[model samples]
Target: MDKHHKINIEYAKKLGLKSALVYQYVKDMNSDTKLHTIIEEFPYLSNEDVGNSIKSLVEQGLIEFNDDNQIITLSSTIQKTKIRTPISNRSNKIDKSWSPSEDAVEVLQRAGVDAEFIDGLLDEFIIYWSERSSTLVSYNSKFIEYCRLKWAQHTAEIDTKSVPRIIDKNWAPSEDCLDIIKMTGIDDAFVRLHLPEFILYWKEDGRAFVSWDIKFLDFIKNKWNYNVEVTSKEHTYKFDLFDPYADDEDKSKKSTKGNIKDLRKKYKI
Candidate 1:
């Protein structure tokens, strides 16, 4: 006698042929089977392909892994009738109140994603897809992909910021940072005027920071706001280069006053 495996054609179409094959194998075994044993059964497929198939099955809620991740079994949600029937292809626009399924959340949590982080992205994700004209058969799968991509990017940014280093003389604000500053209506010349001072101040302080771009942005915003406030208050004060009555202390403050004067004359801010 020979054993027969029932492969779900719909699953094969949705999740590659390999995934459907692996799901059927797990269904038939009905026992906690080692991952390596399954891989050995499929000699024609590469280990990477086999691994991806198993991951796909797990992500789709058709299969699950034991705590150790060495054993695989069918999920409790799996049904024999459901496997035999083709999945419905009826697609509709995502609802404004749509949320990811529990299975999707569990898969992400199993992959070590933080629950709080996942919650934080829900609104942005919902708004983004709700505005689109597209529809999906399985939002859970899409949400899983979205969450994984975002988590990867978030981790990359954290890794970049964690390693603190001294600011080099050659460093300057990135184009993206400059673009954001420009969008706020800050003058390019004003930014240039403060660039050297900003760099010198940090260099002299000898304090390493996670992000100089952020520090520069804060510095520029504060200085620009202060300049605007001072200019508005002293709209009538005129700086005289050679005032006989001007004291040395007042002359020392004249540099800042002069810059503001120049800013008013040039930008009319």
Candidate 2:
């Protein structure tokens, strides 16, 4: 088997370094490859880095995944002629009226980008490149790259705006979180009982989370379930040990001692 891998410089220039490396590896395989195989091949790159590069390759129509998402194959759209040609030999300055090719637009759309969004970016993209002295072999390739970056930034900005901030001292569960707990038949008082401890522990630990409400929900549910189980066991034990002649005060003392032991066990204190 051949160990040498050939990379298309045109694709490399358009996709950037990591994506170019991944593209060549996939192309060389000539068969479906798994995500882990790519990751393993590049020991220096982090898992997230490999994943993002694969995403870029897909967006640019260089590669695609199978139905199970475990196998990757080169896209039929990739042309051997284009890959073999040296881009620099044919490089030319961007024309003032340059627009993306229909194929380039189709590739972006196939990646789930909105058509109107692509249209909106046209004038700005043309103006920015036209003013630059740099030359490119394929303006269509450059356009696809530009659109992918802008779309990523636009969506990231929207996501950042929607969430706004991290966990704070004034953090509290959202109404939706409370409603979910209510649906589980856990009483509101039980939720309130653990609220202070939850807030104090999180605030003191000082870790940022995207949604504190979700953390609170999980914490409350676990604590509630544990309490229900303990209470049921205590009730059964009391029934088994019931004595008609036992003093009421003695029974109360025993119950208090048992609760203290349970509390100590819970806190590991």
User: Which candidate number maximizes TM-score?
Assistant: 1
Candidate 1 per-residue lDDT, tens place, 27-136, comes to 88888766655654554455556666876777677787653335677886433333321112344567878777676789789866799999998998888888897654
Report the lDDT tens digits of candidate 2 across residue range 1-269: 11334678987788887888888898888987765456546645554566668766666777875423345679874343332211224445777777676666787888656899999998998888878877543455457656765665565456556463545667666555664565455677888889989988887887765556657867997998899798878867776666765788888999999999999999998
Candidate 1: which pairs clash?
none
Which residues of candidate 1, in runs, are more than 4 Å off? Answer: 1-161, 236-269
TM-score per model over all chains: 0.33, 0.32
> How does each model score on lDDT?
0.69, 0.67
Which consecutive 10 residues in model 2 have the weakest lDDT in total? Answer: 79-88
lDDT of 1: 0.69
> Which pairs of residues collide in candidate 2?
none
